[model samples]
Every structure is written in C-alpha cells, then in structure tokens.
Target: MMISSWRRRRAARRAGKEPRRNENGEMELTIPRDFRCPISLDLMKDPVTLSTGITYDRESIEKWIEAGNFTCPLTNQVLRSLEPIPNHTIRKRIQDWCVENRSFGIERIPTPRVPVSSTEVLEILSKIDVAFKKEDGEGCRELVVKVKSLAKESERNKRCIVTNGAGSVLSEAFQAFSKASFDVNVAVLEEILSALTIMFPLDGEAKGFLGSVSAMHCLKWFLSSGDLSRRRNAVLVLKELGQEKMDELSEMEGAIEALFKLIKDPICPTATKASLTVIYYMITSTSTNEQLIAEFVNLGIVSLLLETLVDSERGLCEKALGVLDGICNSEEGRQMACNNALSMPVLVKKILRVSNLATELSLSILWKLCKNEKSEDGGVLVEALQVGAFQKLLLLLQLGCVDKTKEKVSELLKLLNLHRNKVECVDPMDFKDLKRSF
Candidate 1:
C-alpha cells in the first residue's frame, strides 16, 4: 500500500502539476480573503516587494504583516523589502493602469446628480423676483445661490431665471432702492451692474430683451440720480450703450449735465464723446440752440469743447467742431468760441489735420470770427486767410455736396469781396473748378 501511494504521488508530481508548495514550504500563491486595505479601502498600497527592492507606507506594510501575504500584486511572489516604496509611486502605477485599461472598455462609475423639481424651479424664480422687487438685498443673495444651483443643473433654466428673473428683477429693484436713498441706491446700482455683467449672454428672447431694457433703465436711472459719482458711472454706461441711446439721452437735462461734466473732467475721455452728441443735438434742434449755447458758455464748457479738437480721439475732435458750429451761430457765442479756440494753437493744428467735415467746421467758425463786429482779434481771420485757409475753403467748395459747406464758402467769398483790399480776395471760379474735381 505505501509503495502504491508513493508511486501515485510521484506520478502526480511528474504530470507537471505542482504539489501546491515551493521549496520554502510556502504556497506559491495565497489569495487574501479580503481584497481591500483597512486604511485606504483600496487594493493593497505597496505590495510587499521582496525581489523588487520596493517599499510601501506603514499602513500597507502593516496590512501585509497581518495578512501574512507579502506578495506583490503584480508578481505574486514572496516580497523582499530592500527599500521603502513611496506612496506616490504606488498611486501613479495604479492610476496609469486605470487609464490604460479604461480605453479598453473598463466600466466607469457615473457622477451622482441632485434632483430638482419643477416646483422648486418656479419657486426659486418667484423668490428671486420678489427679492428684487422689494429691494431685499439679503433675499436677492439667497435667491442668487439657488439660481446658481439651478444653472449648474440645467443651463436652459439657469439662463431663464438669471436673465429674466434675476437680471431684470435686480436692476428694477436697485432703481427703486436708489430712489429711496442716494447712498443705498448707489450701492444697489453697483450691485445690479455687477449682476448684469455676470448674467451676460442670456439665453432666450425674453432674457435678452430684459437685459437690454434693464441696461437702458440702469443708464437712465444713473443719469437721473443727480449724484456725481452715479452720473460719472452713467457716462461710462451710456458710452457702452453706443450712439443710439446716447442720441436719445441728449434731450434729457441730467444727460446734458452729465455729458457737459464729462467734457469738463480732465480724466474722462467719455465726456469728450458725450459732449459731441449733446452739441450735435443742440445744433440740429433749432429751438434748443440759444439755450444750449448759453449753457455752454455759462458752464465754461466752450473752452473744454475747443480743447477736445486737440484730443487724440478723431470722433471727439469732429464733435468739438460740431459744438463750435452751434457756438459760432450767435454773435456773442461766435466770438467767444473763436477766441477760445484760436487761443490754443495746438487746437488749431488739430482742426487743420482733421477730416473735410472738421475743416469745414473750422472754416465756418473762422468765417464767424471774420464777420464778428465784436471780435477781440478780428485779425485772426486775416491771419487764417494769409495761411491760404480761404483757398482751402474754396477748394472744399469744389467738393460741395454738403450744402452747409457751399453756403459757408459763398458767405466767406462775399466777405472777402466786401473787404477786398482789407483781405486778399481769391476768385470763386478758382474754387469752383477745384470743387468740380474734389
């Protein structure tokens, strides 16, 4: 019987099947009952690196010591720790394997979502609206958080609430709040502007229109707020609004003052542009010209307008010329404007370098000065004429599709003819030929 059993065992060993033990009297592979590590709840940190000279963190080492399984996860052999393996290295290897296998169709865990009901959406919108209407700042803040949450969940709904409810609601609320108290209104205005900026590119039609209306309302409110800082901010906002609204705003008293103030302020370029718009409106509106021109002089605004001709902004320089047109239409106003402008040589050079529109404006202004019976330096026109300004005017007349340009040139020609010997007269035909070509 013993011989038979020995023969069977030898036969099993010879069949290429292991006796499940190595020379060291240890199992070749020992699978742990639990695959998770106590500390990390992940696969064993640094598998005991027996031959690899790798080490692991204390928790991993302790786990291997307790499990009595010091084999590497990869090699599945008895580990020999030659040196400690860094936790980072172990993590890197695991992460790299995860990435590599992921491309091969590994199962991925999905991120959890927070569910929001339709009622919650409506309620949040309502709350935001109410907060905005009542000027309840704290309520508005709370609603903003809820709105942000909704936005994160659904961009469509996020845009709806922020744009329609939050954006417009906040703007109106701030306007009302500003009306109640200047300081509070200013604060609310600042906050509302900030909210609008944040909610830009609002999604739907309702939101888009609301944003436009809100922006316009904010601009109007700032202009009407009567606060200097608010007016300054209004100037900036109106500038951003572009020429369309600016043209509409020119009719308002607050807008007029705000624009004039901007022109007068040494620091803001916006004033130069705004002043030009105001001046344009004032000149074109025949009824408002006298009053507007008087206001310009009263406010000491003429000097600044003249000064802007030298400003780097070409648009502003042209606008200044337009303002000069209005100023020079009246006798006292005309003299005042010419004296103010010609006093600044740099301004004169700027005007000379300007476009044909600007040159025509300068010519009209010079013509006014030449015709002024009260001009302190009536000789300025003669001096201007000496520089061939009259010839330039006549040249401009050749290009005369502009009725105003032609009329001004005709009047200037008449003045030169009337003052023949006093001023050197140039033939109108010379300019007429130049005009044909120009």
Candidate 2:
C-alpha cells in the first residue's frame, strides 16, 4: 500500500498540470504539454509526427491507419502522408527529462528500436535465399528470427516485410521443409513458420503462390506436431493462405482433424474462430460432396457443432449452426445428428437463444432429421417432446415468428403429434393462424 501510494504521487507529479496535492498533502510536479502525444495524452514511445503536424505514439497512429482511417485522429484533416516521420528530437528530450528527474523517482526509458524499411527487409530476404540455397538451416533460422523480431515490432514493419518479397521467401522455406519429409529440426521449422505468421497481410498474389498441396503438408505438420503457440500461429497463417484455396482443405490430411480438435478443445478462441471460419467455408462449398460430408461426420464435426452451440457467443454460434444446417442436408449428417444424444436437445434449445440466424439454422437441422427416415420411428419427435422442444416451438409461434419459420414450426408440430395424442399444453386457440397456414 505504501509503495503504491508513493507511485501514485509520482504519477500525479508526472501529469499534474495544476500541481495537485496527494493524500498525504504533498504537492507534485507538473508535466509539460510537450512531453505528451496529442492522441494518447501520455508519454510517447517512438513518437512520430503526421503530415497534419500532430505527434502520436507510433502504435496509436499506425493502428488508426490500419483500421482504415484516412484523416488525422485529432485534427480530422485529410492526411497528405499516411506515413509518419519519427520525432527523434522529442524522444531525446523526454529521455533527458527522465535522467534529470532521478530524485523524483521517474525511471528513464531506453531508446526505441527503429522500424524496418522495405529495402532492409529485401536485403534480409536475399540473405535467406543464399542460406537456403546452401542448405544452411542454421543461417536461415537466424535470419528468420531477425525477420520475426522486426515484424513483431510494429505494423509498419509487418507491411514492409510482406509488400517486399519476404512473405514468398518464408512460404518457399515451408515448401522446401515439406519436400524434405519434415527432416528440418522442430525448432527450425517453428522459427520459419513463426516468421511467416508475423509477416502477414499476404496479398492475393502471395496467397496464390503459397496455396499449394506442399504448403498444406507443411501446415499439417505444424498442426499435428508443433507446440501450442506454433500450432495457433499455423492456424492463423493458414487462415490467410487458405483464402483462395478453401476447396482443397477437404482433401488435405490433418486439415479437418486439426480444425476439429481446435473447435472441440480450443487452444484459444482465436484458433477456434479461425477453425470455424475455415470449416464453414469448406462445408458451404462442398455440402453436396458425399465424401466430405462423410469425412465431417466420421471426424465428429457434427457432434462438435452441438457442443459449440451450447456455449458459443452469438456470431460463432451462428456460424456453427450454419455449418450444421448445411451438412444436415446429407443423409449421413442427419444420422449423425440423431446418434448424438445432446444433438437433439441442444439443437432445439438454440431456438431464440442466440439470434434469428441461429433460429432458422436450428430449424433447418431439425427439418432435415425429421424427413422420412428418422421420423418414421417417431424417435426424434419423442426426443423433442422430452427436451421441452414442443413447448418452445409453440411459444415461438405464440410470440410470433417469420412465415417460413412458422411454416416449419407448424409442420414439425404436426409431425410431433402425428404418432401420439395432441400435446395438451399447446392450445389450438393460441395457434389459430398456424392452423390456417397448414
């Protein structure tokens, strides 16, 4: 408590423009306006000034640009140059102030690393080429580490690395590793993949070059064998490189397996989301392919969707349900849905739990399951009755639903009651218009 209080007083002194008193009644020094970034209102680390004549921390301004903002954040003026030149003079001054205030207990910050230039990234790429040509994995690993460090430093550095030919160079290394039968040391492969993950925003051309059967082999190695961090990075980079190659994922080994594991037991939400996105694309693209649908069911992808629906947030649940809806169009998929005990209850529960998209998708899955085969024995409808799905569907109708949704609900209600007595709770008076619709 005492140390925190002392630090609080020191912080107040750092920013105390009017020299306010602390809890102990000690007056603090006032910070000058010049020491602060105009946007963040804090001490600038690697301050860079825009063409609009306002200085900001490099990160703040870079993010603003990356988010698609074309104007200056503070001035709102159209920026003549999105590129911000470094304000080295101000950084030096802040360093000097910190040194002079040693008695005030404010620590001095070290010089910030300079952001990389495209020319320098190109030079590194050239070195990577020479090292790889000579089969110098050690030299290649060193240069990769260097490139990853630069990319991690800032958005500017990332753009520099990708725009210049470094992204392709990294992909080529992975391709070579795959051709070598994964003989490269695990550490070397990791460094190569880590560098590729950092050098992101691979354009269409770059993605096209990297999207190959060999590249899929490299990604599969990482997904199946690499450590957790490398696995996540592999997924992220795969998400980028897979943009133009979504269809081929179904044929790729470890693609569905790794993605299913991530969705079922996620290392992180980001990986799960990436996995879902890739799966969603693959499923939507190949819903009619018997082999792929069989693959999904065989890999427990449908059961995983049920589990995902139980806890996923609105957007992710919507996606999971969308994939579920698509695959349920296949006979094997519907059989899998009926096989999993939770699939029925969970699919019914998703109605009105998340969103309108979720509701429609859930209804579609149920509709697929009820057609001729599964509903013939009245098993799925009985499962619905046990899970209170009967009540939920009527409540959905009572609360009023869209025409198509109401149509499906009425049809399912008829099917549910077909083999048994009229469900006592769902009053005919409540569904007068529903009666007319059927």
Candidate 3:
C-alpha cells in the first residue's frame, strides 16, 4: 500500500510539470495566483507587500493610499504603516516566468523606479529655500527644475512634495522674486511657478502668501507671458487663490485684458474655464460696480460673451451667461447685448434648453435687457418672441424652477405676452416657418 501511494504521488507531480496545450497545440502558461497584484488583479510589475502581508502593484497601491484609505485592499486589515515593502521573491518569479514563456509572447515587466520619499522631497525643498535666500538664481532654477520633474513623475511624488512644505517654500520664493527686477529673476520665477503648478491646491499658508500683492504681481506678469504653459499655470493658481482678492486682482495692470485674451483664444479647456471662473467671481464681487462692468465691456467682453453663449459647451455657456448677467446690469452692457443680432435670439433659445443654472442666468440677462426702462425699445422683446421664447418660458414655469427663477420666468412671460401681436409664438415643432424666418 505504501509503495502504491508513493508511485501515485510521483505521477501527480510529473503531471503538474507537464506543458499545458490547447486543441490548437500551442503552449500555454497559466500565471500563478501569487504573481498577480491583489488590487489590480493583473500580473504584478512592481509587487510591494503591505504590512497586512498582501502584495499589490506599486502604482495601484499608491493611488489607493493617496485616496485616503489606510487598510489593505484584499484582507481589509488595518495597516501598521503606509510604506510598502518590496516583494523581491514574487517579482523575481514573475521575471523568470516571463523569460521562460518568451516564445508565448510574454514580455518582461521592467523594474519600476523607486518612489520619491517624503524625506527626499523635503530635502529638495530645503535646497530650494537655501538657494532662494542666497539669491542664487542659477542654483534656484536648477532645484526648482528638479522639483518640477519629481512632481510630474507620479501622483505619489506630488503628495510627497505637498506633504512637506513645498508649496509654502515655493510661494515664498515666488513672492520674493516678484519684488526684484523683472528682467533679472523672470527665468527663475517661471521655473518656480511651473513647479508650484504641479503641486496644486496650495496649502493654507501657500494660499495666503500667493494671495499677497507681490504674488499677484508675479501672477499678472505670467498672465501675459509668451509661454502658454506658464499662462495656464498662472490662471490655475489664481483660481486656487479664490475671489476674495478680486478687487486687487482686477486692479492689476493688464490682468483683465490678458484674461480676456485667454477667453478669446483658450489655451486649454481647464485654463479657459479657470479664466471664465475668475471673470465670474470679479463680476459677482462687484455686482453694483457699473464702472467695472463698463470697463469689462470696453475690453469687448460683451461680443466675446455672446460668441461663447452661441458656441461653447453647456458649462462654458452657463459661465458666460453668468458674466453676461452681471454686465447687463449697466446700460452700456444691455445696449451692446441688444445691438448684437444674435443676443436676444440666443438668450431666448438658451432658456429651458440648457441646465437650470444656464436657464436661470439666461433668464436673468433677458430680464435685465427687457425690464430696464433705459433700454426697453420693444424691439428686443419682439426678437425674443420671434425665437419661441414664450413657449419655452411657459415650459420652464410648468417644469418648476427655483423661486427666484420662477419669478423671472413669470415676469418674462408677462413681458413677452405684451408683444404677442407683434410676433407669433411658434412651437419647436413648427420648423418650416422658423427655418423660413431664419
């Protein structure tokens, strides 16, 4: 009986070692379960064992931890430490398997570079501070460039840099450099801003420093810089600084004009939205400041805004409408808006057609245009009726909007009703006549 059992065990081991093949007769190698990261469920490239004894790919685990979870992904075990230990044994096995199965089209996973540690980030920040304090522009430039590279490397590196006081240090350097002669320190300042941009959502201390007069000065300079990337970074940082400082931000030389330029010719979607957001905040902050609104109009904001409302996506259209609402408070803005052939028609078309916010803002602009005695030429109201505003407004009221919006819609209905005889209220289904009018 013992001899028979031994023979059976030997045969089972041999069977396990035999090459696997499908009906097509091609060799197949099933990856061992241990070779896969528990988190990604794929073959581990840079397997690192957690404190919970489970292993995961470095990239996947880092992202998981960055999202604020501190437990192991598989076991749900509380982690003793966030740092993952390298599982060299499993990695070596994976690499060997790749080599053995090279004929099966399996490629080896290249070893990943070590993630930048918080200590290393802090050291770099220290060097940046030293160079900045010494006024060593060349050294500071080099250090900031290194920091920027690390920031771009991975999200892990960004969190590490932000975890240390990199933002505060960089903001300090930016403010200090901005106070100096522009020609001498522009290069270093640009590098610092680039690094700062990567590690965004500036910490509280960083936000305070960047919101200062000097930092705003530096940002204003970058807004008009020839480098598109720097301009984008500057606008993003300006957004992070918030609108509490809009009074100061609007006063910066060429700041509003540069922002208008960015809106006119967007750098990227994010930058364009940031520019629009900043403009929205400025307008909201000074809702009663007619002079500022007219200044924005003089910058050709009205025509640009109308173009945006006509062509932009929903979010951009909403923001554009918000700014337009603020501007139309003044006689000059309402006049420009009414003068443009597309203004009243576009405003009427946007009602009930876009988001609730868009609907509200569009209605607000129309209300301002139609209700203001200074600009109520009846012609604007006639144009709105021609574009089917009456039916859309009725639909908006029935669908129910916020109380404020409901009030505006009702008032708009009343105003449009007054001009019922001038133009027909066409339904959306009445396409032939609508097309003919166009």
Candidate 4:
C-alpha cells in the first residue's frame, strides 16, 4: 500500500511538469504558446490541422511557405505544400480566435472616406470656370484647391471635370490677367497659369480639352499684351504645353500675324524664343499649304528664323531646324527655304554637324531640292554633298534601322542617292575637286 501511494504521488508530479512528445506519443499540451504568422508577421490568426496531424494557422503556414520560411514550428521540417489549407477553414478559425480573445477590445479602423463624387467634382470644375470668367482670383484659387483634393480621390472623374472646364477657365484667366495692371493682378494670374499647368496633364482627355481651348486663349493673350514680362510668361506657358497641342491651336485671323510681329520686335529675346517655339510647333504639327508658306515668306519669318539659327542659343537653332524641315517638305516650301543665301549656309552647317533636328530636316530639304530639279540653286545641293552630308545620311540609315525612324531614314537615303547622282553627273570634275578640297 505504501509503494502504490508513492507511485500515485510520482504520477501527479509528472502531470504538473511541461510535456514534450516524441514518436512514442506520451505527452500533453497544457497552455498554448503564441505562434507568429509569417504572412502578417503577427500572432497566428487561424489555427489549422495539417494532414500530418500538426496544428497551425493555415494563413501563417501559407505565408511562411510564400516567404520561403517553410519549416514547421514543431517538427522543423520543410512544408511540402500549403495549398491544402482551405481558405474558408482558415477564416472560420480566425473569426473564432478573434471572438475568444476578448483580452484586447476590437478597435474598428476608420477607412479613408473619398470626399468628392463624380457630380461634385464636375460641379467644382464648373465653379472654377465661372471664377476664371469673372476674373475672380480668390474664387479660382479656392476651387482649384478643391478640385485638386477631389482629383486625389478619383483621378478619372477629376480628369473628366478638368477637360470640360479648361476652356472657360483659361479664357477668363487670360482676360482678367490681361486687364489687371496691378502687381496683385499679376500674382493672381500667375497662380491661375500655374494651376492650369498642373491640372491639364491628368490624362489624354484632359490634355485634349486644354489643347482645344486654353492653348488658343493663351496665344491671344500674349499677342494683345505689350507687357514684355507678361508676354514672356505667356510664351513660356505655351511652350510647356508641348508640340502636340500646336496642331490644335486655332489659327484665328490675328494669331499667326501677332506671332510674326513679336518675332520682329528685337527688344525681347524671351519673346523671340517664345515666338520661335510657337512657329516651330506650327511647322511640325500642321500641313503648310502654298498660301500659308507664301505668307510666312512675305513676313520675312524665314530670314528671322535663319538669324535665330545663327544665334549663340542652341535651343533657337533647334527650333529653326524644325521650322526649316516643315518648309522643305513641299515643292513651293523648298524654294521658299532655299531662296535665301543665309538659309543655305546655315542649313548646310546644321546638316554637317548633325544638329538636334538637322538630320531629318536636312534629308527632307535635300529630297525636295532633288525632286524639283529647277529649284536647285547654284551651290546648295553641291555644298550639301561636299560637306559629307551623304555619309551622315548613311550613318542615320544604319542607326535608325533598329528604331521607328528606320523607314524615314530609308526614304531619305533614296532621295540623297538620287541627288548625289545628279550632282555627280552635272559637274563630275567639280564634285571630285570639291570632295578633295574638303
């Protein structure tokens, strides 16, 4: 009886001690230890029983596997598959755990609320348009801030709102800003311009809307205003809208005329750059008919552009090359471009150096010159050939072969070869001598 009593006491002691199980299966789990889930890096949410009869949070196990930390907590063996953990089972376990763990009161997280709806966004944009029309600087600012806030919530809706609203807002802003002679007015207008620039690039629809309306208004404002600083600012803004918008700029009766006048005004280099940029955009974006080319020729814009090209400013030269390319695209355009002595030398030099826009433009100009053989002046084609322009053309063809410009380069090469042959045939000895001189 004493030995039996001693055995019972020993069994009680063993039960009180922490148990560890081996292959023999003689152990007991008392207090469950907290397990970390690899996915959330938090305490395990859903305790699951695996096929191996091991219990774990399915999410935690899957996360561990996903993170490449696939070792089981108890066995220290890599998990073969996490796919066996049913999502619904894991969710139910998590729900039960959350319900039982009342130690921490459930705190609801407040989701961020989107303050603006589609209709509200449109309404706000309409207000901005009205504010701009009335020259209400304070109102415009308020609406702009509101619109921006709404845009942050729903980008697509905000873009739609702005696209429809740009024209009215731009026109009003220009009118109001132009009429104000005060510094305060200038400050307000600057803000409006700044706001427009920010809002216009939301997406394609927004850009198209601004392009069709705000661009024209901007051009008009610059033309009507004598304030050099304001004109300069307007030009800067127009240039920033990019070359694509230039095609959309409506050629109202006075727009191009005003630009020409600004170009003639030598006092403002800033305005000149702006005007050149505008002309460059026009040339690149639109088709130049005979009448329009004639108008540009008569205005002496070509000579002005040539002068700008020779100026120390690299940007101006780039713009002029773009313009020259436009002019040389047609038969009449080629004659107009080549008629001036200053035009040829500068164009030749630009071609030789491979200036920014020069290669494509030079190829274009050469093509036109070759097409209309009578249009070829004394030394224009020969000078181009002598200056190693053909070699440059060849190089462009080789490089552009891998890019979208390949087809253009190929056509240009064909045109250059034709012109090279003409020059060779006309004065073979002269061409050879010129080549040697170079």
Q: By lDDT, who's the top model here?
A: 3
Model with the higher lDDT, candidate 1 or 4: 4
Stretches of candidate 2 off by over 4 Å are: 1-30, 49-56, 60-83, 95-110, 133-135, 163-165, 184-188, 226-233, 243-249, 252-266, 314-316, 372-377, 394-410, 413-438
What are the runs in model 3 whose C-alpha is more than 4 Å off? 1-29, 74-76, 102-105, 286-288, 373-377, 430-438
Candidate 1 weakest lDDT stretch, 10 residues? 29-38
Writing each residue's lDDT as its tens digit, candidate 1 over 357-400 gives: 77766766666766664434345555555445555555555555
Candidate numbers, best lDDT first, in rank order: 3, 2, 4, 1
Candidate 3 has an lDDT of: 0.82
Please give the TM-score that candidate 4 achieves against the real structure. Answer: 0.47
Clashing pairs in 3: none
Q: Would you estimate the TM-scores of all the predictions?
A: 0.49, 0.74, 0.87, 0.47
Each model's RMSD to truth, in Å?
20.6, 7.3, 4.9, 15.5
Let me know the TM-score candidate 1 reaches against the reference structure.
0.49
10 residues in a row with least lDDT, candidate 4: 429-438
Cα lDDT of model 3 by residue, 224-264, tens digit: 88789989989988988887778888887788888999999
- Please tell me which model should have the higher lDDT, number 1 or number 3: 3
User: In candidate 4, which residue pairs clash?
Assistant: 48-56
Residue ranges of candidate 4 with Cα displaced over 4 Å: 1-191, 194-219, 239-250, 262-274, 284-289, 311-314, 352-357, 375-379, 385-438
lDDT of 1: 0.54
353 in model 4: Cα distance from truth in Å?
2.5
